[model samples]
Target: MKTLYDVQQLLKKFNIYVYVGKRIWDIEVMALELDHLHQAQLITQDEFIQAKLVLTQQHRIEEQKNNGRDL
Candidate 1:
């Protein structure tokens, strides 16, 4: 998981599609779903870790951009 597209593809592989009109929200939901999959032993720890890293970094970058506009 290196980008939103990567996460989207990961979700797609499991037939888990979600769109909340915001990329960040979509990624967040995917993170939750990935967690469930991990808990269920459906996905590996490596996949979970990579997906989470991508989501967190992307979200943080977006947040920083939003904050920058307020200054």
Candidate 2:
């Protein structure tokens, strides 16, 4: 998908919802859940890859924001 919300919607199709009270943590958990779904062959390779790319981008953005706050 093109955005984090798209990725979340993908996971939601499988009844997976993650919220760790932090954006970064939620993204991390979503990655883990995506991995599990991929390993189980529940999602297509293309889906997995696209979702991962979205998560990675969101994670990077979140990291940068958090880092900025610390400075």
Top candidate, metric TM-score: 2
The C-alpha stretches of model 2 lying farther than 4 A from their native spots are none
What's the lDDT for all of these models?
0.84, 0.96
Model 1 quality (TM-score): 0.86
Q: RMSD, model 1, all Cα superposed?
A: 1.3
Off by over 4 Å in 1: none
Q: Write the per-residue lDDT of candidate 2 for residues 1-45, one digit (tens) a residue.
A: 799999989999999999999999999999999999999999999
Over the stretch 43-70, how does candidate 1's per-residue lDDT look in tens digits?
Answer: 8899889988998998898788878989
Tell me the TM-score of model 2.
0.97
Q: Pull out the clashing pairs in model 1.
A: none
